[model samples]
Target: MWLKKIGGLVAILSLSFSGMAIAETTKDNFYLQVGSNRNGDPIVLDLASVKGTEYTLLEQHGNGIERRTLRAACIQGRLFSRRLAVYESNGHLTRVDKTEQEIFPKPRSADANSMEIVCRVAANRTK
Candidate 1:
């Protein structure tokens, strides 16, 4: 009876530890699909390469027209845009506008407009 209890405890502990490992891996590697542009081209934002509190917003436009990067911050699972400076692929700041609205993730909804850009947490496929 004592041996059975010990085995059950071990199994429980192992499962908890595995869950923690999975959470840690996903905590910093979240991605957001930023939707498509006015031209019907898709855009994806990758936050998986974030380091510490700072993160690089990699904007990959579907067409070969525009590709930019913006410096941002992530706080408690909510990403905040810090500036309006859009940088080129070569690290050159091209446009700076203080009126640019900050971006954040929103819940996926069925009534979302097709032209409007909506962001949501990327689904984890490892499950």
Candidate 2:
């Protein structure tokens, strides 16, 4: 009887650890698919992470993901973006970069689509 109880406890512990491992590999559901980029990869925006004029965008790369933090200039329709970090498909941080770039979206481009959605959301919040 005691041996059975010990086996049951060990089983429970293993299940709990497996759950934690799964959680680490999955992303939260708050990121919404805004549009697709030039390469047809899905571009997602973390609406819940928006702060003031800055928002987080996640782009699907080969087997990993690249996350960028961008500040919007709504009136001028521009985005100031910085490469924040990259994560593996298993949701592990690979590296972090702070290289900044200024974007002026050309007509009918992926960046233009993203800028429109982001600015609209930001504009609505101020009212």
Candidate 3:
């Protein structure tokens, strides 16, 4: 009797966990929308000055315009949004010298993230 009771409890716990996972997925979907402003407003990406090696992060968010600084690292980086592709530079794992045709028109084909990095292959060649 005890073994049966314990098995039933485990089954209930498993179901609860699965339900929670679905909820988490729904939360992430909000960010995929272009003008949705899932976090109540758009995020502002920026680079900090005075103390730095030049890495821009999503620093602020609000006031309608999501701002971002075009720093050196960003010059040949890879950024993606809704179907629009942005070619910019990030430090090591990036390659920003390849032309749009060579990158996007690759032979094998790839996801957005890979396509962007492939285009910027001058810096990050292999992996």
The best-first sequence of candidates by TM-score reads 2, 1, 3
Off by over 4 Å in 1: 1-34, 60-77, 87-92, 97-104, 109-127
Summarize candidate 2's per-residue lDDT along 1-127 as a digit string, tens digits. Answer: 1112112322211112212211111233344455566777656666666777788877776677778888888898678876688777767889998888897767644455556667777789889
What are the root-mean-square deviations of the candidates from the true structure over C-alphas? Answer: 16.3, 13.0, 19.9
Q: What lDDT tens digits, residue by residue, belong to model 3 across residues 5-124? A: 112322211112212211111211111111112454322211121012222222112321222222222244433222112222221222222232212222322223223222344245
Candidate 2 clashes between residue pairs 3 or more apart in a chain or in different chains: none
lDDT of 2: 0.61
Best by TM-score: 2
The whole-model lDDT of each prediction reads 0.33, 0.61, 0.23
TM-score of 3: 0.16
List clashing residue pairs in candidate 3: 76-88, 76-89, 77-88, 77-89, 95-120, 95-121, 96-120
Counting clashing residue pairs in each candidate, in order, gives 0, 0, 7
Candidate 1 residue-wise lDDT at 40: 44
- Candidate 2 regions exceeding 4 Å error are 1-28
Query: What is the clash count of model 3?
Result: 7
lDDT ranking from best candidate downward: 2, 1, 3
